[model samples]
Target: MQYRHLTAYALLSLSIGLSACSTAPLNLPAPHATETQSLLHLEDQFHLNNLATHFPDPLAITPEMKAFVKQHVPESLPEVGRLRYLTEALRNPRTFGISYHSGLTLTAAETFEQKHGNCISLTVLFIALAKEAKLNAWVNEVVENQDQELLADNRIAVYKHINAVVQLPNKQVVVDFSDLGDAYLRPQQRIPETRAAAQYYSNRGVDMLGENQLGLAYQYFKRALQLDTGTSYIWGNLGTLLNRMELYTEAEIAFREAYSLDNNDHTALGNLERLYLNSGKKSEAKQIRQVIVRRQLNNPYWHYGIAKQAFEEGKTEDALRSALRAIRLDNSEYRFYYFAAQIYRELGDRDNYHKFGIKAAMMRKAAQDAE
Candidate 1:
């Protein structure tokens, strides 16, 4: 999960939790429920007697899942053939043919039975099946280093994609069930199975919170923090829930914990700012707003959005300036180059237009070929 400016809207991450498993067997580490710090007073406040104890394991392989793999991936086939057949069967319309939806975060078994789920559910299912086939599989957080759309409720949904990766002796295959292709974020972060399971719980908490199931949401968030105490987004999510429950003191702590874990992800900071404002701490809120502005100024995607808007408004010079700034900040995205080419074309600078256009086309082709 990633964070963005919070004043404009609440920021939430829709991360799919795909945990890692070794080739020998799927012996994922158990959650360190005792060491968690984010959910300090919430257990007593919400009367969470069992807390993280009773929730079903999101990655538990059901009989149906095992049966599907056994029938489609024959033991007679070589390792490579088995892997190929498994992937094909998962994607084949005549087989599992899992589809995408942004609803509940389901377990691997539930995803298989339902045949539809969001990215998180799909990736979870993939890792579970890969484990059943005795393959090295894990979850990776693919950061696009980009901003996402704002929902109707004025929430900023900055999505960090989750995908399953299967490793072989000489090669690694990323089964990007999200279908993001090669145009994914760079510098992937591998999640431990325990933390990945925490992501599942956190995602489910988000879903429950959406449906106004506050008590259940609290339970899910508690389980998530217990599993992985380190994730800032989960902390931030719990903070959001706490704030909703009017547990302001604990909410403050959770938000602070989140910010301390990852200052780069500004969700905590944004929430903090809101909390300050609500408590009549205008000076603190002002200071946080300044910090947010400074961070936004440094973001290349923010500048790119500005450039696009300027171009649409026919402010050619202004668009060019912002586009160039965006390129200077990050030269990896092809869309920036393509936009620069358009600006140059509008300015009648034929040589530079062709230069940027060619560069954009080459970059785009390279990305596709890499896939």
Candidate 2:
């Protein structure tokens, strides 16, 4: 395997929507006076500007729908006097063709009322309800190729499931009606203090980056930070992007922010150290090295950090040793073998270099095999 060029330019051309909203359950602020006014304006403009689009044709309430309302709609309101209801009553089931691109068509609210919708419909319902309740929400689309066992057949399918976050008066809640099982009013679960939304964007950005779409990845990382500034991973990733762009000052600031958010983050610390060293800020680099030494006494990623720093500084032997230790602890990481091979090449150790090169190739092949 050759030294993979992780260029920032690759992420530049991918186009993604910036204004997409979240539908996951989370505490969100109600639309303020200004936001409400803006939303109303947009809604009016949507009707006036898009005259060709048709409104939902209201159908007569069927006996099943009426029964569903009676059984599912809560008789009493909550203490806050909020009357929570699905968008529309249940409808007759229709067999959708596999060609139906469900997600591209439905809104979150529509999915909620329909009671039995595809992934896209459910997502649409989640977003619609959040907006109707005047809460802030957004949408995240995850893309991957995996196999699913359906009943008796094992088939390869691409699934797009939509889950939402609702910002209640106090806390954020995740609403997933995809597995509601015949029940219409089941409550969703609350995500622990984890940065799910941030991680979602970060992971997307990483994928785009891998595909050589740097500009799009940068936008994703920026959006991730906007959603959860406390996420150290996004901050560190942003710093790495800045570094790739050779914007040293901006990269330093991002690394500092990441370190401030989580001092123990090895990625941030290592990147910061590398930045200081490259810029000839020896004193700062030394200080960072001291911090790394102190933390490495107990941390898992310490050797990985040390290996990366050594490789960057042209310390081939040290880099090779530290990278080998890291690989020993976690052989699944391709970075370990990749960097170790580079070090072996630098030291003119052709045999060892080819060995590590083969290891890196095997690791990548294994990942693709598992997928």
Candidate 3:
């Protein structure tokens, strides 16, 4: 799953654990459980900090942007004008364009000021702007293609998917930041405002976790879970957070909860496998490895995950090889192209990077045309 930058709200990625396949996993039952002592303290002090701090209001609209929306969307608007003003214009560099930056979760004001953000950031901006225009719009976390990658902190972030849904007087509009030609955000489920806010915190938590800010990340993840306990991915991510803390027991419980919520969620299962192996349960680890292998066959995302891992390890050739394999398996996934381009760029192959970049741009156009 991958979110496309430059697209308003492209549905993005998710990754289950992959350590289950390690021929020899690391030692487990972590010594001192990392920071478990501080964790208990956080359990108490964390509650003292209100959820509002973590899930702060992301819809802070600026007066200038509000006025811009007002000027563009009149009470009586032409169909073409409505479409242009609401979608194209906001992203057109020559106009009131917003830049697309991946791996971020920005509030509306942040997006506006920076003019850049990931899919969720763009979606939140869209929702805020649409509301300012007196339009009915909301955020939706639709079923999506998940893309997983290793972060700077050696943690993994399965980029979640989000989009903005606007109900016009006579038509409904879906604004997505994606390049693939998928018509639906898979499940197309409507997410309430509160749940969307919770996601903001969860994504930020992922970022913080990658930065090794365990306490801060824990607070964000906890708030996210409290706001929307049903999101299996959040539970899975929470498990990852706990694992990094070396809190194996707590991590296991979180992963199990995630697995029970979404049996097919390989990420949770993967984390569980890691936990078992880390704790010296080789037999259990082997069992999980078998399951992961069975579930990965014919799954293009598996190849994509390998590509990401290789890239992280500075294996450009391997990354490109795996990326090409992923494309061969599923050319419809635009994200593979993005990775391919990045790989080429890393190798100083400017021509190849441009070639793949253009291909990705063309696919994005294809998606927009289909839309």
Measured against the true structure, the TM-scores of the candidates, in listed sequence, are: 0.79, 0.35, 0.69
TM-score for predicted model 2 compared with the true structure: 0.35
How do the residues 130-178 of candidate 1 rate in per-residue lDDT, one tens digit apiece?
A: 8898788898777655342311111445456677777877787666755
lDDT of 2 by residue, 19-132 (tens): 323233221122233422222122231134443322231112344434444554444644122224432222223321111222233322333344534444444443543344
Each candidate: RMSD to true structure? 9.7, 17.4, 7.4
Tens digits of per-residue lDDT for model 3, 107-162: 88888778778877788888898877667788876665443332212234444567
Better of 1 and 2 by lDDT: 1
Worst-scoring 10-residue span by lDDT in model 2: 1-10
Error of 1 at 271 (Å): 1.1
Q: Which stretches of candidate 2 lie over 4 Å from their true place?
A: 1-194, 300-371
TM-score comparison, 2 vs 3, better candidate: 3
Q: How would you order the candidates by lDDT, starting with the best?
A: 1, 3, 2
Task: Score candidate 3 by lDDT.
Answer: 0.68
Top model number, TM-score: 1
Pull out the clashing pairs in model 1.
Answer: 16-120
